[model samples]
Target: MRIEGKTFLVTGGASGLGAATVEALVGKGAVVVVADRNSDAGAALRQRYGSAIEFIQADVTSEDSIVKALDLAVGLSGTFSGVVSCAGVAPAERIFGRNGIHGLQSFRAAVDVNLVGTFNVLRVAADRLIKRDRTGGEEENGVIINTASVAAYDGQIGQVAYAASKGGVVALTLPAARELARHSIRVVTIAPGIMETPMLLAMPDEVRASLAATVPFPSRLGKPQEFASLVCHVIENPYLNGEVIRLDGAIRMAAK
Candidate 1:
């Protein structure tokens, strides 16, 4: 699938990995629709890219909200071809802790935002792609990329909710791909480990360094641009479907 001249929708595109992806897509001559809850960041991005970027303040968990963003993307181009679901929340809590126990609402919030939110975008995007009219040489109608975390596999003691939510994302990749294959829509998930996102950046220097040291090689935190680069590759590589690719630098997280 050629990225140039194409239009894509990127959820959580206001910051972190999603922002990097928006930049990469625009740099590659693709128009991008940024769907995020951050209005300030959306304004900044729209200013940065001008007409190349269209931003909609969106809630990934709501189908109506996602539909508006999708409609905006399709409006920008004749048809929107792909979506990268990077909107997620990570909550740390133990099943039984000093706080007595994790709140059910918090657990539900994590799953609702991270897992269900991702599925919402996939389903809505798949529907739109399926209805699109394709031209010759268009082998695939669209691609759906989801964001998962390494915690899904090597969850630490306090990451029960976060891990379970991401674990669900990992579990859904293959099935989603298989179901969407007939529509020529690819589904893939990316599980990143210890990236330098805003949450980690707020930690003390020593703490950040300690986390970086956990990676076997590179010995540094992953960059959002690197993740964006991988996203571009995934979009271009037609064969990479129904797979969860770990973007970790050979790091297997230890139990905390």
Candidate 2:
């Protein structure tokens, strides 16, 4: 469970929470594989962290890319002890629109990225871990932390597509964990509320403040470091499996 001398794969490692997790792992003496769609961002991360990090350009929705990513993680460093699936898209749309129209393609795309994309990383990573060698550690052969959103449970009006995709992720956690238990790999999810990631950081200050104000306690956005810290804790603590931990601060979203 110790990160020292272990390896980890972080999908969507180019930016946002993924980037923060990568940095955190690296700081703890772990070698990291940064798999992301943006080659430039990956390159920049590599440059920032030097040789401790490896990167592969991959699309989470494609099986071929997932294969390449897993292979690269092993080939470039070695078998990974953990995987963090943070690759997701948050596209907003309603099932029926104001004009009585809906874009099916857009809805499907949201599902593809947020739902199916996460599963692609999960299944493939578990397969590789099942076949790889493990160090001596109780209930700690490997770990997978998936990213979900509070929207899955409390979706606002305009977030139908985004919410549905995230909901599927939340739904899959327990079953996935139960099935993978025998293999010594643990599965868990984190449903974050309002985080000051790039997506929200790009919004105006007033808009961001309004979003943070929705949180009843602390009344502010969650920090990416807080999420990363919990991930580290989950990895160290062996019994925290098959649970979806919400990182939202007492904030249950309302219908917008």
Candidate 3:
């Protein structure tokens, strides 16, 4: 799909990877709606990007919230062409550990925000795309990109909830693509490793350095811009459907 003149909705667009994606998309001439729960950050983004971006405080786990975001996107650009779901929560807790058995609420929170949130955005976007009349000669209707994590494949000692939530995202890619094919909407997931998000950046220098060393080549934390670049590439590449691409720098995480 052409980036220029198209519209996209980005969940968690207030900061981190989602913020980078908003920048990239706007640079490419796409109108983007920033959907996030951080009102202050959303206001900040709006101030930075001006009218090129729209900010809507949204929660991806709520269907009503997602619908409002989608509505705002459509209002801005007539209709939106894609969505990049980046809203997620990472909770570190062992199943049985010093903290006692993991709380069911915590586990549910991870799954709800990470896995189910991704699905909520995708489903709502897919429905909207399916209902819209196809533009002549435009073979693709829309793209849905989900954010997973390397933890899905390499769950460490304290990542049971996070890993399971992300794992569900990894598992749903192909099926979503298959079902949505007839509507000309594609689904893809990106699993990033040790990204330099705010959480990681807040760590002590030595701890951050130790984590960066885990990556095999070009040993450093993955940049949010790099992930945004892949998102742009996936948006333009017509045949990259139903795949989960790893943005990790050949890092196979070790159990801690």
Candidate 3 C-alpha lDDT tens digits along 1-256 = 8999888999999999999999999999999999999999999999999989999999999999999999888767545798999999989999999979999999999999999999999889998888766665888999999999999999999899999999999999999999999888999999999998999999999999999998998799999999999999999999999999999999999999
Worst window of 10 by summed lDDT in candidate 1: 71-80
Residue range 1-256, candidate 2, lDDT tens digits: 7887878999998998999899888998889999899999999999999988999999999999999988777665544787999899988777788867669899999999999999999999999889887756445679999999999999999899999999999999999999999999999999988997998999999999999888998899999888888888887888899999999998999899
lDDT of each candidate versus the true structure: 0.94, 0.90, 0.93
* Candidate 2 TM-score versus the reference: 0.96
- Clash pairs (backbone) in predicted model 3: none
The runs of at least 3 residues in candidate 3 whose Cα sits more than 4 Å from the true structure, single-residue gaps closed, are none
| TM-score, every prediction | 0.98, 0.96, 0.98
lDDT of 1 by residue, 88-132 (tens): 987889999998989999999999999999999999899889998
Worst lDDT 10-window in candidate 3 = 71-80
lDDT of model number 1: 0.94
Q: Could you tell which candidate, 1 or 2, scores higher by lDDT?
A: 1
Model 2 stretches with alpha carbons more than 4 Å out = none
Candidate 3 is scored at a TM of 0.98
